[model samples]
Target: MASDQPRIDFSGGAVGYRFRRSGERGHPLVRAAGIKRDHMPSIVDATAGLGRDAFLLASAGAMVTLIERSTEVHALLKDALARAAMESPELAEVVGRMTLVHGDARYLLPELKPDVVIVDPMHPPRRNTALVKKEMRQLSSIVGADEDAAELMRIALATARERVVLKWPLRAAPLLEAPKPSHQYAGKTVRYEVFVTALKPHVK
Candidate 1:
């Protein structure tokens, strides 16, 4: 059955399943975001799609600011966060760490100086469409590809204090060439490209 309400339910459904199945400490997303026990970097998720990665970062104790340009997706994320906050004490704590922003990140990034800026722009549709999840398919159909992803990345790189992380398909080319040497953390189907901006002296 299709859910009428957008939910970030960590207790049940696909989100819950993923939460239980993935080891939080060793998850690739956490590793890629440079999450540590002592130092959890403030992250700006520029393309906060389903709020999955932002939620993960929040759960790991990082303060996350999610920016969603699309009104529909932003509403979904907002509803999900609200529901999750009401449902469980643990989830409420995580929700508290997340700040939702409705606007294009390009316009907002200048004012917010976060330690890490994470960009997970929408990928182009695959040839085998059946492999994609239904919700993702719907989102892609509604939002289309992020043609301005490179511009967003440029802004992120300029604004981020420590680094700018980009999540892309395992085989896809990067949106922009790195100014400095970058690192890669590969998952089964996706990979995170880490560009160390080090714009601030205290970044290390």
Candidate 2:
């Protein structure tokens, strides 16, 4: 059943266009990730759905570990990364910074001490289904919503050395109430809530 799912491709087509366009400094996701050319943070993407956010961080120079729990989604992501790596020198370099791990981040985060942990759990189903992308719809049909996202945030808070960033719909309530974010970056459709740990000394 999983094999019947569509393969993820980033090398060309609409996804490719978004990939290239996202590399710019002005892209909302990039800015929300707090990426900078001079000081890229080592990041752990706890909910690496399609690897878009992780790839953006790597393209900006951060060493990124992408943790995907779904076997089907992980396979697609792996295949996509392998293809992108062989497509061009620049792409290869970006792919080099990304590491894919198949497992639950809640279990893995304790062992990883990244500068930042990013959590972009699935959003609640939209009333207008057409507003959601086809690829995302497919993903939702397979993996379902991450209902325990609040618990994931708790684990991330304990694991991250510097900060934990949670991506959510612009108008949706946060995953949890306590441990409020130090600040947030808002875009038209999404918002990044940043919880500062301020733990041991680490690169921003």
Top-lDDT candidate index: 2
The Cα local distance difference test for each model comes to 0.81, 0.83
lDDT of 1 by residue, 1-204 (tens): 245323344556666666556556677878878898887898999999888888888877889999998888788788888888888787788889999999999989999988899999887654444424566677776667898998999999889888888888888776676564388888877788888877557645
Residue 47 error, candidate 2, Å = 0.6
lDDT of 2 by residue, 49-84 (tens): 888788777877789999999998998899999999
| Shift of residue 51 alpha carbon in model 1, Å | 0.4
Candidate 1 regions with alpha-carbon error over 4 angstroms: 1-9, 18-22, 127-131, 200-204
After superposing candidate 2 on the true structure, give the runs of residues whose Cα lies further than 4 Å from its correct spot. Answer: 1-7, 18-22, 127-131, 200-204
Q: What is the C-alpha RMSD of each candidate to the true structure, in Å?
A: 2.9, 2.9
**Residue pairs with clashing backbones, model 2:** none
